[model samples]
Target: MMKITVALLFGGKSTEHEVSLQSAKNIINAIDKEKYELTLIGIDKRGQWFLCDQEDFLINGDSPKDIMLKHKGLAVAFQMGKDSEQLICFAEKTFTKSIDVVFPILHGTYGEDGTVQGLLTLANIPFVGPSPLGSGIGMDKDVAKRLLRDAGIPVAKSLTYHQWEQPGINFEAVVEQLGLPVFVKPASLGSSVGISKVKQQDELFAAIKEAFAFDHKIIIEECIEGQEIECAILGNEIPIASAVGAIIPQQEFYSYAAKYIDDQGAAIQIPADIPKEIAALVQELAIKAFQVLCCEGMARVDFFLTKEHNVLINEINTIPGFTKISMYPKLWGISGISYTDLIDRLIQLALERNIKDKSIRKSY
Candidate 1:
């Protein structure tokens, strides 16, 4: 039997580029070599793609702040071939490799916010994670919360502001609406990049400024007092949710540094110490949000579980971290799926979704 050829795409122009490298490293280490032939492709900060050597793909791999993609390999471009999407490398000699599937380990902005998904869709290639529409909806917190709230899902009250509205943003008015200790975040970013916890009225201006720097739009939400709970969802039409997990962040919140940089910044509590009933509810809501957001393949549904057992939808990560300590794989690991098995499942899911999508008549 021929092994499946998997193109692992990592790094990007996003602020989470370093985090994506870490994720790609873990995925490459854990993926089953016997069942899959891996082609490593790293995207640089400028959005250029290069075919990478699996062993020597990264520079400064040990230091998170300085880690970068080693751009020595053949610069590549994705093109739609006669039968499938081809990765064309134009160097001393031109060659093409047909990719069976793409596992985009990229997080944030250009990679996660539907841009790459759209490209893959146009090429009619099978890639892991949500569809273009799903990725777009999942990346925008402001849009996601509105959809969830409309579907009768509980979410924290918030306000959305574009860069143009900066001059009119009244800190006192926002405080009056969302209350104190609001979270200011770039609307379409993840890994907690450009997110600030505004505790005082004076801090609101700086927080908004910081968030707007990363994105054209920002969201301000009332800080919900509760435990940070997360549930991982897998599959397409009828997805299943994994056992719930909790993030015990040592910082004021799960900042970018706390997530990837600091080893002891956060403690991950698997099978969160919650009642079975609450866990079940969390799983139910997780699947609901996944479906509501049009997510397929996989997603990590974050929530705020209050002392009263109320679960408030926070946000959805279409391409959640796959790092050694990342919650997505860890939650599934505790739920009877090993890391390799989880990767296999995701690949299979992507293939299945592609077949289903192809079945739909395009000309009719």
Candidate 2:
């Protein structure tokens, strides 16, 4: 049997580039070599793609702040080929590697916000994770919350503001509506990048300014007092949710540093110490949110479970972290699926989804 060729894409123009690097590294290490042939494709901060050598794909150091993509690999470009999409390396001697699928281990911005997904969709390539529409909906917190709320899913009260509307943002008015301790975050980012917890009136504008630096739009959400719960979702038409997990952050919140840099950032509890009934409800809501958002393949649905057992969704991460300590894989790991098997399942899901999509008549 011929092994499937998988182009593992990582690193990107997003602030979560380093996180993506770590995810790619872990995936490469855990992926079954006997079943899959891996091709490393690294995207730099400037958005250039390269055909990276698996052995020398990372540089600087392992620390999230210092880690960087080794750009020494041959620059590559994705183009439409006679049969399908082709990744061509531009060097003294040109090379082309046929890819059976793409595992884009990228997070945030261009990588996660449907740009890359759109490109792959147009190139007629099968990639892991959600479709382009799903990715877009998942990345934008403001849009996601609206959809979830409309579907009768509970979510924290929040306000969305674009960069142009900054001048008219009244801190006092916002406080009156949402109360103290609001979370200011870039609408389309993840891994806790450009997120700030503003507890005081004086801190609100500064937090908004910080969030605006990362994105054109920002969302200020009322701080929900509860446990930070996360559930992993898998499959397409009939997705299943894993056992609910909890995150006990050591810091004020799960900041970017705590998530990626700090070793003791947070304590993860598998099968969160909640009632079995609550766990079932969490799983139910998780699947509902996954379907409501049009997510397929996989996603990490985050929520806030209050003392009263009320669940409020935080956000949906289409390409959640796959790091050694990341919650997405860890939750599934505890739910009877090993890391390598989880990867296999995701690849199979992507292939299945692609076949289903192709069967749909494209011609009007």
lDDT of each: 0.92, 0.91
lDDT of 1 by residue, 1-364 (tens): 7999999999999999999999999999999999999999999999889989998988888776677788778899889533454888989989888899999999999989899999888777899999999999999999999999999999999999999999999988998999989999999999999999998978989988999999999999999998999999999999999999999999999878877888789999999999999999999999999999999999999999998888898999999998767999999999999999999999999999989988899895
**Candidate 1 TM-score to native:** 0.98
Give the per-residue lDDT digits (tens) of candidate 2, residues 248-314.
9998998888778786999889989999999999999999999999999999999999988999999
Can you list the residue pairs that collide in candidate 1?
none
TM per model? Answer: 0.98, 0.98
CA shift at 283, candidate 1, in angstroms? Answer: 0.3
Question: Over the full model, what C-alpha lDDT does candidate 2 score relative to the true structure?
Answer: 0.91
Instruction: Compute the lDDT for candidate 1.
Output: 0.92
